[model samples]
Target: MEHMEQYSITIDGRTLTAWEGQTIMEAAHDAGIYVPHLCYLRGLVPFGSCRVCTVKADGRFVSACTQPVTPKMTIENDSEELLDLRRSLIEMLFVEGNHFCMFCEKSGNCELQAIAYRLGISAPRHDYQFPERRLDASHPDIFLDMNRCILCARCVRASRDLDGKGCFDFVGRGRGRRIAVNAEARLSDTVVDVTDEAIDVCPVGAILKKRVGFKVPIGRRTYDLEPIGSDLEARRRPRAAAPTGGAS
Candidate 1:
């Protein structure tokens, strides 16, 4: 295999190296630069559905998860305009769904909630839809709460690509769109299991494992100690060098 040439691009005035054919999100993540996103998992194909990873590059706003990084490209991610856009998007997600993080099991571990905290969104700026949604607890080991779904399709892709089960999919168009199991009758009739990757990749509290609610305790969950981008920022720090020339 031929070695891909590496080049550098400037993001927020910081020069970061990236390889050819790599998307801006991929390059940024590999360089340990945090770019807030949903509907984009590391190993999964970029869906670009959420539009939360939007960043301005050379005066044009583009989805960082899908746009390829080019040499000499100047990307702007921390500007006030971008921050406001992100906040508005987060707020929209809040109102579109019945998050109710206070009572949800995935509250502390939810990426959506963490992103909301990171963007300083104390409340939804938009009107709440309060759509009447349903919950499916037919499965013995897993359940689905349609109310909390952001329709990011993480589970859809995970089930299709990773699990090879094609157990889940989106049914309906536009306002009526939603995640549906293959059986369509009930979750208990499907082949999905508790160990499926789809059960774990949900950004919101839509899909969850059963019988383990509140196991970690409140205020002691994944994002309770640190915000979403904290780990990415920590990854950006330089590591200590290993001792050389064997034991002295």
Candidate 2:
């Protein structure tokens, strides 16, 4: 493959080299810089709906997941204003649904919950919409709890792109928009398998596998033990090589 162009960009005052074709979030992650995001799963195409990854690119705010980095671009990711805005977006997601983590099956292992913790959000500031969603346990091995869905579309993208099964897609418009099964009213009427990527890619408890509930204990679940993106933070800004044997 032709070499991807590389150039420097500054995020939150830190300088990091970024490759061409990489979005702001991608470049930040490559440098072990944690840019909070949901609805932007790696491997799948970036869907900038969530807006949690919004950052200022050269003083113009844009969704980092979709905004490609440019040479010498100044991106403001962790500014107080940006953090406050991100927190608001996340809070809205929480309130838009009935996300009762204490009662939800995906509580501890949920990416949405994990991100809330990572961002230090104890509770949402926005009022709950509680849009009167319902459950769809029609599938023999899967549970579709619409109440917890933040509409991140990770399931939609994963099913379409990763599993090669377009079993999930959005239907309706605006507030009425919701996930729909392929050519079916319910999941049981669709072709979704229990092991499908769409089922596994749900960031929240919206789409969950059944029959193995509570398999992960309360205190030992992923994100329960560590903040999300801990792996990337562990490698934060891979140290510049030791200067090749103590200075030239």
Which candidate comes out best when scored by lDDT? 1
Count of steric clashes across candidates, in order: 0, 0
Residue-level lDDT for 35 in candidate 1: 91
User: In candidate 2, what residue range of length 10 has the lowest lDDT sum?
Assistant: 239-248
RMSD, one per candidate, in order:
5.8, 5.3
Which digits, one per residue and each the tens of the lDDT, describe model 2 over residues 1-248? 54566768888888877877778887888788888888988778888999999999998989988888789999998888988898888898989888888878788888888888888899788788878998989989999989998889998999888889889899999989988888747889888899888887888899988877888888898887789889878987653321111100
Q: State, as a TM-score between 0 and 1, how close model 1 is to the true structure.
A: 0.93
For candidate 2, report its TM-score.
0.93
Regions of candidate 2 where Cα sits further than 4 Å from its true position: 239-248
Q: lDDT of each model, Cα atoms only?
A: 0.84, 0.83
Q: Model 1 off-target regions past 4 Å?
A: 237-248
Looking at model 2, residue 19 earns an lDDT score of 73
